[model samples]
Target: MAGGLLGTDVVTQIGIIVRDIEKTSQAFADFFGVEKPKWFLTDTIDKTQATYRGEPCYGRAKLAFFKLGNLDIELIEPDEHPSTWREFLDQHGEGVHHIAFVIQGMQEKITLLAGRDMPLVQKGEYTGGRYAYIDTVPQLKVAIELLEND
Candidate 1:
């Protein structure tokens, strides 16, 4: 608790994993009458990987970004890869993956979380942004992303 923080305590950006990124993104747009969000295929993603339980795995995914009422909504379509998202989708279709939070003092947060022995599910840089997924739920669990310039 010293270096880490409660997810609820952080202002969050919610991302929903869906069977179809286009469909879900449109749904949000239609409901709010907002413009359709831009889409991003896995090929376009700056980085892509999977996590099985909490280790490196292989898979494909489609992602998109949109803005609604100051909230950035992301649609993720997990491929048949062995990723945490894939597991979630397999068990529960498409749904909320994580409540992402952008933080200042990011490197500090990373060190703090690591110092506490939290296992990282995935870590990498993409599209000029650096991010890490920490499975704070037990040893291997859901990820809380610290996306920079997201």
Candidate 2:
């Protein structure tokens, strides 16, 4: 198989979809013997953009991140919206939703994946970075999220 446009194999984060961010984050912290992860509401995300099945849609999630070694363990609680997270939870239940990789030249990478028939599912910007989720479940059995941090 060919390598991705990012030209790397390292996973930056493993995102898990949940029904409740607070409960799930607490449980993860307890199981891992770490402090409770901080939560961020999707409504606070800036420059957010997303599409579902090629149509514009609105979705929100409450998210928490716990750094584990070189990668983060991300928990996402889908809000009342039609988003990829919500769709995943509805179709597959609570589980691993996507694996993330940090990359440079995000637009070029997105174009490359889109050329390969992997459409962008969702995207948003945060404090110092932005992220895009690509729909790759049919071929890879999981979505791929690309991150570009400033």
Candidate 3:
């Protein structure tokens, strides 16, 4: 972890929480002159095994992605459930939620970040991967998401 926690500082995705994914996604697509990527809802709690603050979380969000260069711009519209996305939107309004990096050794990375004072906030599973959100705003001014593809 010399260069960075996961051995790389390269960010693969920037996640933004929005109150209106349909409008925001359309705006982004129009601004970039790219076709609007189809928005999809995340898997349910049972399927995703999502947790928030150490508790089972039923929250989910509508997601859309814009691939730009090496980074993916993600738009998230969170449901009313208690999720990091929903909490961020409630407290800070629509804005960047997290910067994600694809990495291996998810558990080790989480432990290392927690030792450095950035603890885990929320985590969940996607179709092909798992993700953990680290509470790094105090030090980095933004959250860090670790995505582990299996």
lDDT of each: 0.66, 0.85, 0.94
User: Which 10-residue span in candidate 2 carries the lowest summed lDDT?
Assistant: 43-52
Evaluate model 3: give its lDDT: 0.94
C-alpha TM-scores of all predictions:
0.71, 0.88, 0.97
Write candidate 1's Cα lDDT for 1-150 as tens digits: 543463335535676779887778788888888888777655323343434445555655687777656577778888876666676699878777776776665567767777778656655556656666666656535557777654
Q: What does candidate 2's lDDT look like per residue over 29-64, in tens digits?
A: 999999997898775433464555566657778889
Judge candidate 1 against the unseen true structure and give its global Cα lDDT, from 0 to 1: 0.66
**Residue-wise lDDT of candidate 3 within 1-150, one digit each (tens)?**
454668878899999999998899999999999999999999998899999999999999999999999999999999999999999999999999999999998999899999999999999899998999999999999999999999
Ranking by lDDT: 3, 2, 1
Q: Highest TM-score: which candidate?
A: 3
Stretches of model 3 off by over 4 angstroms after superposition: none
- Clashes, model 3: 0
* Clash counts for the predictions, in order: 1, 0, 0
